[model samples]
Target: MSSTALRRSLLAASAVLVTAGVWLAAGTASAGTLTGTLYRDTDTPVARWLAANPGDSRAAQISSRIASQPATRWLSNFNVGTIESEVAGYVGAATRAGQVPALTVYGIPNRDCGGASAGGAPDLATYQTWVNGIARGLAGRTTLIMLEPDSIALQTCLSAGEITARDQALATATRTLKAAGAKVYLDGGHSAWNAAAEQARRLANAGVADGDGFYTNASNFQSTANESAFGRSVLSALSGRGINGKRQVIDTSRNGGAAGDWCGDDNTDRRIGRYPTLDTGDANIDAYLWIKPPGEADGCAYPAGSFQPSLAASLATGAANPPTTTPPATPPTTPPTTPPTTPPTTPPTNPPTGACGATYATSSSWQGGFQGQITVKAGTGAVNGWAVSWTLASGQSINQVWGGVLSVSGSTVTVRNAAWNGSLQPGATAEFGFIANGPAGTSSLSCSA
Candidate 1:
């Protein structure tokens, strides 16, 4: 596909990319990143519930928020007759919408290690036949295939022979899907799971080197910051094993609380993390995806994979948190509290932008390169799109950028609104960040919309 088409497809592909939630720390993103849009099914379980229960009090808010968001669709069933046409129809819709459809191939035998999400094709031959249906359905369309969640990470249940068979199956499946123009990401669990080196070894054994990259935090609630760091660590370890230029995608759904609670009940306060987009400024991360759709039960709360409206409502409203304070009725007096000997230092802030102009701020600096961000705000009138440009100082060139699409001509660099972030109401603001080579430099920034 052409670059323009790919950009259009990636507009809302991953989570809004600035890498970190606040760009508070330097990222390990490399240049030449993959960008695209994610497929949003209008037929989610949330949508079905809303259609049937319009009278419910929480329906409207849920419709406005949860129902409209893009989510991953799992192909865990093995219907031989209709599977090809069913997936072909899905591919056709995504093609018409110009978005990259993500399908989670979650039907590995002994899936979830006979845990809540168990069952797959009966054997290796049956699974390969099932995979052949998926490839034909893809019809060589550009697609993102999340090979198997927990397939690589949760391999403890398999015997030595089972492990080798499963890994070989995954490698063959990766090859098959890639042959159909699909970008495949094998599972890498989350930051809280396997250590980087161990995960890297597992990934290499499973043929991650031949695929696009690997995914992390599938259906878990580790913070994106932690996931990004862990992904880079995994990528670094993979590189040491001769797997170079690999990227990562993170699951941001149901993790907005930034906590690590892993369930779908009301007690485990969680919310939607970030919207799907490919503008993550981190070079190593491809996008933030909603791998596990919110509102779906995690088996602990209800039957696994069923949509629960009350749970969805809880996520939408978030946990009702009160301000931190000691309750007068039960103040503890058993132990004395001690304060830190050294005071905490204040952090740097980004300069506010005015009208069409923008200001660049360096968040942190290292030996040769520094991380920087550009804050852009709309002027008095509403605008559909915006662009910011500046001249690169000698020995200063950007390596990667997120939150905007970047273009350059010699010493001049320009970044424009991505497909999803371009339209702005009057005075509305957006920001894009980049990691540049050499020392950070200052230059007058001119922006227009």
Candidate 2:
């Protein structure tokens, strides 16, 4: 070959090496990547409806209800046409800004398997159509996709006949999406929700062998330390079925802290946590994903089926986004008296308060029960009856209460000390508290009245 040709070949090889190096460096960094569903700012299905009718009250109400539920909205939002555009914009901005924002693709039918958290495609036909659109949205993009969360592994709650149908639907969805050139990860629930063998069997039954690998901890809180072990076991089980991957990825969404309960309404507390990291114990185990978006209510801080602005603010802080640091130290115990702050009694005429206070405490505890005490001091006038109301974020409900009368209204939790027990003497203070389960890091005291 001529000298010029030899030089050109060497240059080409050097370029390839440079690209590989960048990819490798990105993989090893301590900063965890972000990954979750891409959705439009609005919360409605007509937003994607084919008919495109101008207005329909029934559809409007359904959309409003579904939009209120973050999980449902997270999954269904992909159906909207604008979602792809939003993601495209984010990718461009991140690329220009020199960052890689990991992303996930949810919105499968039968998500969460008919539980209180369940909402998905209307049917298999609708799901297939939606999948195609999502693939189009992702075409030429570099965002990671956590496909069809909880659709395959959590099917145990279905009947035998229903399971068969769901399996076919999931397999079809996975194959169709993969064909669209989207890398997909079927949710395997979490280490705590299902055993390795069981999850593997279900995935196999759902035809996960056709996809890249399965995902775990999408929205669940199985610890990374525990999820890695569980992931390997599932991978080993798949080994017998001839799946080629060495390992799978797990979600680190709310796993920075301990695990939360499966079901408890008043469990509306939020906790600050680190972002998703790539420190998987095994090589085959891919990067950890924030499949559950920060600021999206987990039914605890938000309404049972809605998003809470206060909760979303708490999630935006670095403490929960790409969790690298530990959350603020929770008060060891409820202080005997309110910290001496003679601030005005009127509510702050503001939105997006800091990550400390009653809302933050209750929203923080949505994942774990709150352990604290509140003393209600009487104002200048003689105090009449007292009510200690604890309103949960969207989707959260009252798990348990002590020392007061507790009432639940959708996502609002109220604890009232009745008239018989209501009087507070002038210059005297009334004290009460309740051990309540909520989301991770919820605001504790809304009203000390």
Candidate 3:
């Protein structure tokens, strides 16, 4: 190949690698490569949803899509008496599985600015005592601790004195967790909410110098690319302040789709993001973790942290866009806001070959779910009706299907043409999209009428 062709090919390959989290610059060592498998909690919210709603339309989708992925286990309440044992049991399970447990320590006093996720320890002293129990449970094994979700970032309600007190408490909590052999990531707000410089300074106040690093997008829905880039900027800022070598993680729990309201059930555009893993190609990014379990309310729709299967199903529709890193060229601004119930007006680029033909593609991918579209085309002859079938992977299921009728019997899923779409001229095509539960599955499609 010519040198130019080689360079272009190399660049294309590089872009693909970068999107999978292998973003490279100069001498930055990737964070997740050295770690063990990130832990998967058996009792995650989606797990419970599967148990209770097996007969529900979205149960299978939620089971294979969201519930199968590992999410951070947040210790939000301050029941000191059981905190240690509770943590110990979780850690033990992770140890048995030989996976690295990811824990979120959220009992900070006045968490969430007293908003939907309000309530923490009564005071800093109680918070410390509570953290100590969490530490004891760790017992010197390696774990990832997201010290607090918004303890520093969402501090508008606090006075200067109050912010200072919270800062000190976080510093103490970091030390306690680290001493117990945990890799503690102090909160670094998120890219959308705080400027890199400001959050770096805030993290400094919260003792980023002593922690493993800082984490971003915990319970917030910012794209992983945006959050990971923000983390690099924060690290650079931290280095300027004489604190260096800090790695970061992003909560890719529910940031799929567009950047809109980060709370409640009203937003249909929200989707789950990348699954948890430390293998981010970017050395500065430790992992893209699902810190906030999908389907749980952010205080707007249901009580804070209430898991809803229907909500999970909606978010899972991004194929539950599997929280991939780089999104394809900018998504059309208006497309996500509108439901995809209407078939696309455009014709298929692929001409019809047989009486029926079908194709599937992932429209956009994010943490928990992905959006997929299937195009049905008439081959050499006009077709009055058609059906397409494929076997879903173990965890693959459908949430909302449009432009077609959907049914699942065991792993095999079949979609038949909708009323308007069933009638197609030869070589004409009709398309449909749906929110799927898991990653885009193998495309061994069979079409018939």
Candidate 4:
């Protein structure tokens, strides 16, 4: 899609992008990192929902599925009891492991620009009440709070008159949280999604003056180079607005590399970072964080609410293990096995434009094997293996494979264990092919091929 069309779609998604949160540290350290999701100690509707269901399911699933989007990352459905317990678990783990955990709080209202990730405290009054409870849970703990992800920037969807009231509430929340002693990093969305000036203006207007600064690259990838560029611009704007005194953080969670898509579509599986460590490359940038748990859905990319285990494994600490090797073959001259392939078919189509209603679409495609092509350009940087995964609508099989190994499970296809074209640079393109055979009229395209 044209950049203009992409921006329009992003602005529309700005409403939903407002829906999440993240965490980081006060000082820099070596690369290994600690990260965790915030869960309430109370066993409210959300806890009840997770308990009753199994395997990556949660109570928010009902509303989220019905809305055809992700459930707001922050919701009050978690009771105080759950909050306390969860916080204790986080604190305890951090304390014991000697690692700080990155956490996000999303219970704020109108998250994600009213995208599928909407919902929050009923109003400012109620949100403050919830904040009080959250503060109590966070008391004496050293944790970074990604305060109200999309609340500030995405508020344009609100009626003009209501904007002041919204800002007022945000100011109040910022003060209250800061007073409670929590280190708060207000989300600045990603580098590509919001203009620096506009982001700074909204943040300043929303009272970021009282904040620790802003966060960028949260759950989106525009590249660290781009993010740093974008962040400095936004910070410059914020400075102009008199809110530049604070530092900023970026969600380095899944952005080991960059692609245009949101989900794991590029599936580059760059093992540049694990938990707590950040390579953000900016001193004022504070820290790079894995705020978004590796492998968690940006929302169902392949199957509704299903977690991509391979993708998850690739992201998790498991990637550190040594690879297994086979013993020498009986026939010393035997040729090695050829990688998987399918009969030739249609070449890849260009990537589609606009943010589709489908959850986690960006991160879930092969990204036209662009990720593999990244290093080809530089020809000098270290190159690692690659993996790409996607879930077909069902009844689909590998029509062809080029440079990578292909594995199938039910409706999902994972590309691993094959030769990638060349070293992948920050933003490269790659493509794979597939053909679906289902009942007549059942095999319609779910999105751009």
Candidate 5:
């Protein structure tokens, strides 16, 4: 062979070897890398239901849909004697599966503010010991830790000294969880609760710098868009206060569509939201998660904590976008000269021109009960107050509502603004939710303001 030919052949062989080596490395990384949020793959309520009722079509459907989805495992039972072993077991299983485990370390003192889902360590010392055990069980494995859901958000419910102690406990817990190779996310209340600045300040005070970032909409029914926007605002505020590099994850489990009244029962209108993803496009946003498992009770349908199979099945099988029928235009009601002490049973006839408009949806339903939500949009002008009215289909009756004053007379229901949520500027929106009892679900609802 000529010298030139020999040289060319040698160069081509070298190039081929390098290219093959690159391809092999790329394939190895792709196979071994943990790319997305981890699916714990543990048995949940839906799984248990499916196992017991193999012949039930509804249970089967729900099982099939959520069996593979990722959910946060809660570690809120302070009384459980074997917490360390349980945490270790969960982390070990997740590590073997090549996934990260997400846990909620809920048991802070004064937890849930004595609400239905209330109970925590009797004192701060006990809480610290419990958290230390959790950290010890993690054993330096990569895990996701969602701190107490309402711990920082509901600080106002505590006395001054209690708030100080809560802050110290949270800080200690944050440091402990992080030292064990866990990514800790502090709680930031939903968009509707705290203003961005106030929430950011509270997070900073709770030692957010010791963890990965903050989480929003934990067990709440706010839309992903709204939560994301709120998350950004809070992050920006944190940044302004010199707290940088903080990332956020949102609870998209039940916020499939629009925002709903957080305090309503039977809200079956909620559908499963965006699947968990690490590549959220936004730099500061980490993942969208089912922090609150979809099928679990939200304290309303089944005694605040008990699982409701009917409600769970409804949520699992429902459509993300249920068909909505626009109600016929009703003449605007006259502005009340004085705000009524009670929500009027009858809707006003003349609402101010461009006062507000509303859209309603049945969030979820079971055999004899259903949940409903209303979103009132402020018109071109500011709205000092507003009222919405809707007539239920036969057999439906409003039982309880939150975020608004609800007055029901037979099938017709009138909802007036609650004291705190009554005012809105142009383009602003106010949402309220309620639960009703009926056999026929709220398939079609007409709402007008």
Candidate 6:
């Protein structure tokens, strides 16, 4: 059949699938079925960037804030011959480690509307085959599948016939992934993109009844609270259509309370959101995830997919910084007590005075790397901010640090307070840690704040 003729036939077939109620009767699954914590893969884009550019001004801060957190791994390309094996490897490793693996399936035909991430299977049949490969790769393991980012939300870009075909493709993919023990979440776009009722209708057309639920703010910067409300509204619409027992998740990676210019390269308001948690209190909301890894350029500042250290730093420090304030409820001075009847003894020597003090400790050690922490204590008065500097004697180099902004020069490492962790009242303390490459032994580390 000619391509056009075949597509016409498929659209007709999909129309029948939509009206026949085949997808509606499919069993419902809850996002709560997902158990255990999400995994943080050791090798991520930010991790690689930190290793390559240790000298970048924001390297330490970005690495420290992001490396330990869990983010989604995208499996968008379907052309690679080893795609199946790659999926199996990632899912299998995650399962064995007692962590949940989140994967994004973005290989729908005409993906991304021919924009920055514009590539996918050329036709529905090829796309189905690729999705089947992804299913086989799952090997019946529990996984989180973000079906597609823009497939449904952007259906307006397609003709009526094309929209029908796209719906069929999404429906097929959702069914296939669900059958393979994956929890599927269709894209509901951000709260700002489509009305709750409208996006819910799109999700229904894309066969959400056969899947777990839908996700909002996939790659956008909508606030968590806003996305939660939006997701519930979408689910409410779905329930009104007799699609109940559905749940949702939001991308909280960069929605640091500010929705900056979506296309600007120098958006410094981007800060990290809450860490992933399944206990979101709302029974309908599953978890807040870092769907779009921070520091990855959003088609500007750098190449669309390249890592921008400064952008990542902004996420690490942006909203996290709060103004320094005196410690709440300082003890009031009392009248001097009368001198004891005993003869006055020599006045005790005063303890050493200093601006701040820090103590270093090693947390864990592996073959070629170790994790260490530093605790900074304020002395005498409140501190607006602090910087701790230390020298590594055993050739140890930091690859990642969290909870502070870090810079390295030769063997000396310096860390400054992040916006969120600064402001220590008198006697209050703050701590930060880092993972570094060195011999598996203690080194002469000194800290001054």
lDDT of 5 by residue, 53-129 (tens): 66776755465455456677777555334567878878777665545467877777567775545545656776787
lDDT of 1 at 114: 52
Give candidate 2's TM-score: 0.53
Candidate lDDT (C-alpha), each: 0.68, 0.46, 0.68, 0.44, 0.63, 0.65
RMSD of 2: 17.3
- Candidate with more favorable, higher TM-score: 4 or 5: 5
* lDDT (Cα) of model 1: 0.68
| Model 6 C-alpha lDDT per residue in residues 1-449, reported as the tens digit of each score | 00000000112221311112111112223244333456566556566556666688876566566765777777753433556787887876775554567887777767766544444564677678779888898877667788878788876568999999999889999899888767788888888888999989988999999988888786677788888899889989999999998888788777875784564247776677876555456677766677777777654333344466777777888445312221211111442122111111122233115767776765545455555656677777778888888777676777656567889888778889766557876776666656566753334444344
User: Which of candidates 1 and 4 reaches a greater TM-score?
Assistant: 1
Residue 5 of model 3, lDDT score = 3
TM-score of each: 0.64, 0.53, 0.65, 0.52, 0.64, 0.63
- lDDT value, candidate 3, whole model: 0.68
For this target, which candidate reaches the highest TM-score against the unseen true structure? 3
Root-mean-square deviation of Cα positions for candidate 5 versus the true structure, in angstroms: 19.6
**Stretches of candidate 4 above 4 Å error?**
1-81, 96-98, 263-275, 278-281, 300-306, 313-449
TM-score of candidate 4 relative to the true fold: 0.52
Per-residue lDDT tens digits for candidate 2, residues 1-449, read 00000000112221211121122232232322222222222212222221243254333332332222222114333234344554555444433333333445554545555343434444556557666666565454443456666676666667899888878877876676566444556677787787788888888888777776777776566677787788778989989877755347666545554467742223334333334444433565656555554334443322223333333333332342222232221222332121111111222233223211232222112123333344455554556666555556654444433334668776666666533335655444443333444443344566454
- lDDT string for model 4 (253-362, tens) is 45554456655633655332322233334456655654553444443233212233444444433233212221111221322122101111112233223211011211
- Looking at model 2, residue 351 earns an lDDT score of 26
Scored against the true structure, residue 199 in model 4 reaches a CA lDDT of 82
Say which prediction, candidate 3 or candidate 4, comes out ahead on TM-score: 3
The TM-score that candidate 5 achieves is 0.64
Q: Please list the Cα RMSD from the true structure of every candidate, rounded to 1 decimal place.
A: 23.8, 17.3, 19.4, 19.1, 19.6, 19.9
